[model samples]
Target: MRSNIYIGSKRRLSIIALGLIIFLFTTGIAHAQTVDGNKYQLTLAEAIRFAKSQNKLVQVATLEESAAKEDRKDAYNAALPAITANGSYQRFSQLTLFTDGLSHSTTGPRKPSANGAALGIDALFNIYSGGKQRALQDEQQSRVHLARLNTLDQSGSIALQTAHQYLELVRLNDLQKLILDQLNRAQTRLNNINSLYKNQKVTKSDVLRAEVVLSNVQLSLQENENDLTITNRKLDVLLNIPDSVRIAPVDSAGMPKPAIDSLLPFIESAGVTAYSVQKIKENIELQKARVKGVESSNKPSIGFYTAYGLNYPNYLFFPPVNQAYAIGFVGLKAQYSISSLYHNKSKVAAAKLRERELEVQQQANNDNVRTEASSYYIKYTEALTRIAVNERSVEQAQVNYRIVNTKYLNQLSLLTDLLDADNLYQESRFNMIRAQTNALNIYYNILYISGNL
Candidate 1:
């Protein structure tokens, strides 16, 4: 009875130890999962927003826009009156006159005033410049618009690039999962072959083949891991994040998939709304304004000018005077560049030529955008079709693999048949994933071309 009681206590202790180990293992796994979940996760929209704000190209474009705004301000300031102040002081030395040569007088020397001081203010208001100032203002305004359009273009380009890399990473992750699953199956197959070989049911060659296949799957997994790391780093650069941090996309399923009811709207929108097209249109306006400015040089410029000042030892009088005197004058000023009459013709012609060139460029850009939009629309539709086809292929390949695997296990088929079916199965799955990602990518491309992204 004592021996039975001791055995019961020992069994109870063993049960408690087992329970403790299980609890600790589960807790550790949960903790690891929590840590993984805490890692930085980003959605596509968040990434695009971050990139637009932080990307070097976008920042450069924004700076250019700011500079253009400053230029506009300068142009406006040119139309305002210009005022200037001046002040000066000087000590005069004694002056001697040669009275003996002209007057034949014995007076030795005469001194002018001891010192002189002057304070003055001048103002010039441009009342007319043959419309040159107004034209320049218009040109600067167009430049501001162009710069802003360039910034928008840069932002859109970066967003598209970010989406590409982000989707590539997501695709790689999905492929990794598939490859890992295949690796396990390969390992199981190798083990099964080894077991059969030990029973003398399979040849040594069969075992070697299974090992090679398993090795190949492992190699694929390694290659995929390398690609994942590289893609993650690229995305980090785009996001302006630290290279050491790895980013995982939160979800790609939320990407827009607009219906393809009509392609005409996209094409039309791209021709008018795309940043490139808008920039060209602004450039044409800028060139026209420049032409007007060049032509204005041939005409006269008229302005109002005024000056007022106080002077000591005033030199305006014939004899030197010691007392301070106030002086003031106001008049209208006109200027005409005789050389510009001949020289400005060539400049105006050149400016007009540039304007025409921009108009031609605008036409070309419109055509290109329309073509691009139409092409992407077709590709987007094609990708949807391919997705359906690949889905069916995956189903067929999965069924074929199961049949071949069962046949090999029952010793009714060669190992090569099983391996081929397995490879086909993996390829089909890979194709399916590629098709899905390609569809999403094409959708984004369409949006980008249409300036809607």
Candidate 2:
């Protein structure tokens, strides 16, 4: 019975020990996760979103659009009546009638006092401006549309820039990984050489050569690390994140499928929808409206004005009286600028010339878009082809490295040959990574050029 009791105590102790180990292991893993959280892992879409939210260029475009909206509102309010108020006080030397012998106050006229004051409010509404008001309103609305299109253009620019930065960061990160792997292989090679030298199978020179190769790999590693750091900082600036924060992109899903051959439809459609093209079209409309406004300036403008007034020392009477009176009047007034008829002919001609210039400019923009779209599409296709070729090169390089490494391990090949093969292997991998990044960048470039970004 004592033996059974001792065994039971041992079993309980074992269970407690197992539980403690599990708890410690879980705590360590949790700590590691907490550390990783310090770095922000950004995806391509998220980076674009962040840039849109915080980029100064995007913000500036948005503000410009808002200002344009205010201008449009002002144009709308111009159609409403305008009300004004005025008050004046004057101390004249004397009040005299213009009639003959009005200075003979003792015989017939009584002179008024020197003081005069008046307060009045007037409201005027332009009943017609010969289409000037309508044309101005249309012009402002077109400007508002142009401003919106400009905002879209800025947004596309910022998104494309962010995407490029992110892709570069990914490329650098992968490059660092490749360098680290190469360094490990170099170290392993050095150890093997050292063992062979100790056994007298290889010369001291071989060991020294291996050491030099490892050092070179280490230097390369350091260079890649430096590049990674700079890339991270640049991406942080683009994201508007704190410079101290590190950002890393998770493994991307790779490049999107290319429809380069069918890109003609997209390119052709872009001319009508692209911001630059649309802005030019709006400009043409705005200039035409300006011509109408200038033409209207030559026609008669009729306005109705009404005012209520209080005047001290009324001057309406024959002799005048020292008293205050309330008065009101309303009337229609029409006036034409005879000089506008002569001057506006030239002005209208200039405006029409400007409109025609914009039309020509718009045609140029359309042609540019077509050329740019086709060029980017071709570039994207070329990048895709390069990726495929690099993939095959990487495979061949891996095989060559393995054969050279095996021969060196068997003391049948020189260390220099092995190092050369390893360098080629590393270079192949780097090239492949660069090709992939280039392909992704070109893909986005196509989208940007097509105005689909």
Say which candidate scores most in TM-score. Answer: 1
TM-score of 1: 0.88
Candidate 1 worst ten-residue window by lDDT: 29-38
TM of each candidate vs. truth: 0.88, 0.84
Per-residue lDDT of 1-453 in model 1, one digit per residue for the tens? 999998997776556434433433554422211114223556666667667777888889999999999999999999898999999998766554556587653443334566778999999999999999999999999999989888898999999999899889878988999999999999999999999999998999999999988999999999999999999989878866556556667655324456776545776689898878888898899988989889999999999999999888667777876578888899999999999978888888888888899999999989988888888888888988888799899999999999999998899999989999999999999998888888888877877788877
Model 1 has an lDDT value of 0.83
Per-candidate clashes come to 0, 0
**Ten consecutive residues with minimal summed lDDT in candidate 2?**
29-38
**Cα-based lDDT at residue 434, candidate 1:** 88
lDDT of 2 by residue, 95-175 (tens): 344545664443322347667899999999999988999999998998898888888888888888888888988888888
